[model samples]
Target: MRRPATTRAITRATTLAAAALVAAGSLSACAVGGSDDGPLVVVSTNILGDVVENLVGDEVEVMTLMKPDADPHSFEISAQEAARLRSADLVVSNGLGLEEGLQQHLDAAADEDVPTFVAGDVIEVLEYAEGDAAGTPDSHFWTDPARVLDVVDALAPVLADLDGVDAGVVEEQAADYRAEVEQVDAEMTESFASIPAERRALVTNHHVFGYLADRFDFEVVGAVIPGGTTLAAPSASDLADLVGAVEETGVPTIFAESSSPDRLVQALASEADVHVDVVELFTESLTAPDGGAPDYLTMMRVNTERITDGLSA
Candidate 1:
């Protein structure tokens, strides 16, 4: 059985924080690119890295730059990893301004003429409905399985065209993965539909669930932070407004991203007039294999169940 989100979240956050410190010292010594035999696909975030790995399997070497449980909005790459980007056969990123810290490296690779596949480019982008980032494109499209299918459809062709990858194998894997995404979408639709309309309000740590809310018919009541990126801080008045929304909506649960600490969400819950529970969801990055949200599919499933339970209660 999987551990409780609170238990797992605290453990993973503490472990990852220590790991980051250790990694800072050892990253330079660690290898960035894989062995020199096959075409290498360097991915910006671990979530998309898992997707590329699933699609290409052993056909090509896949290098994911972001560490597990790291914030994509602020995670930075080492000099070695940045150098490897220019030499990669294909560079994949969850663009739409998500990778704030790594954008320069991505741009550098693009300027060098490295082929790039941005997941945001192929999907119908959604803008933040109401926040400091209200008019900007949201990079959290992976929250919805349907949009993820769009990414897979566009990415499969790119991977197949790579020199060392087998077109037939990549095509077959893409089809199978597409089916999995479709199944998950159907399941999510059914699960979310069961939620009472009035109870389907969501409060989160940041504006990361617009895509999921748009896809599932949930109302985004408010967020602790006012924008799309976690790097931005929420003002006292901003928190006051969110507390009012929580009271007005009577939203019982507020979600915190697994990649970030839940202290802010906890504080928000405490300040709300209505009693609220804080739940953790895997929004930004994939976790290590032993972590609860190890891959994209599992991450979606885990979040679906958690959201359903949180709102229903």
Candidate 2:
């Protein structure tokens, strides 16, 4: 549920007008303080920020525009925050239209000729639904470690191109990271393969696991949201149809996303008389530092364990 374009425009206009007024008076220093210098890396979402930070280590300063547990569809940056986007030397985004709210800022940054990289662009996409409608690619490629290996592959060259970064060092590190990703992918494949082929079906809140299912050869029976993004609401008929599908498919678990509430899925489970395990998979954003699914590697591992356990029974 993103704010309307009109609302965003008004907000941006009002903030800029206020900044101008303050600059004319006494608050100029406060207004200018947000433009401090560093490596000037701008990441679209927090999950990608964690990945980039792990790749770059302490070599560069990174800032994530989206906060922890923030919905990617609706998260908005302030005017001062938008200034950071403009001043950044490198901008990394999830792409695949994950940052619906910050698209204008991204476009403006592109207009200014800031170097931008889309992590999802490197990975092969899984389209759950078709057409120019909103939320098509599902944007949950990180769920599959294989797909994220593609991201790591793209990221190495991009980091090498940045100023003050050693291309050779980044290349070696990227190769090491890609090996790790491949290992994880192998582990996931083995783990998920344990679930009997008959039970290798998934029921989720939305179309979050298309990539994972495709990679591991699981059937995506149905989703409560009935769309690629969580922004779409399921109508009563849609819910009824989904419940029927769940009953027909006999999927033992209905997985839920870490960032989205699961009340609807719970209710659907109760009404359908099926055992729905609300497995918290990292669908949109990564968890906080102390949370279970804190980073990309851990997130995929935890999700794999959960999915395997839930389906094996």
Candidate 3:
């Protein structure tokens, strides 16, 4: 049975409250400049924040700066958030230039000798063309469930050390989540494999699917924005070239992120005189609880279904 949104929200709130209780003394210890019993981990993006919360469960106090649907690239942190970052026992960031606004806070925390984990650093980064300004290691690795399992593997030990938590329990939970991620990965692989190889190329607003393409053997021919970050605007010529590429490649689908407007891709599709499907994917942020891509697993599954169905059609 599908859980109601109110019930899910209440469940999430209750889980968070439990985690808060477990980490309260640890947070207090950190506030008093003493040894912390548990870790206060702050995630820069809500997507990573969700994964962190899942891995840690109710064992650690996990706070996220970016809310649901918040744009991670341009998100601004308030003074209270800055204080939270400063006092956090550990800080987890999506990294790879995803948190442009929170970089300073992360650096500040690093300066204070707090343990910081960049989830991107754990995965093999996919780089873009040399002259392309949007070429940074794509920060959306969690789009691939296997890569998220890798993150859970990396996060297990860090989460286990938090105060008021049983290390064994945390490790056990992490293992269980990792198994689930593996199952999701296998399912996605099978689902994506249903699409013929020739139809597997992807064109999106930005280079958000590097990990997915790499994992699933899909060719990312080009992006409308031609960069790693979505903040860059595509030049008229860039659009022309991308449209031309789309025409030549005959890829009927053009993906746009939930946080980005589809106007540019829509215009390009019209100009190219080809039918383009501008499917929305949860790239930088997860959808609201009631929306389609509320969690990591569902987000990837929805994206996979869209890509496979669109391209296959």
The lDDT leader among the candidates is: 1
TM-score of each: 0.88, 0.84, 0.86
Task: Rank by TM-score, highest first.
Answer: 1, 3, 2
Candidate number of the best TM-score: 1
Model 1: what TM-score? 0.88
203-313: candidate 3 lDDT, tens digit per residue: 888877778888889888788888877788888888888878888888878888887888887877788867877777777788789978788778877887888898899
Task: Provide the clash count, candidate 3.
Answer: 5
Please state the error at residue 86 of candidate 1 in Å.
0.8
Number of clashes recorded per candidate: 0, 0, 5
**What are the lDDT scores of the predictions, listed in order?**
0.91, 0.81, 0.82
Q: Give the CA lDDT, 0 to 100, for residue 251 in model 2.
A: 81
- Candidate 3 stretches with Cα past 4 Å from truth are 1-38
lDDT of residue 226 for candidate 3: 80
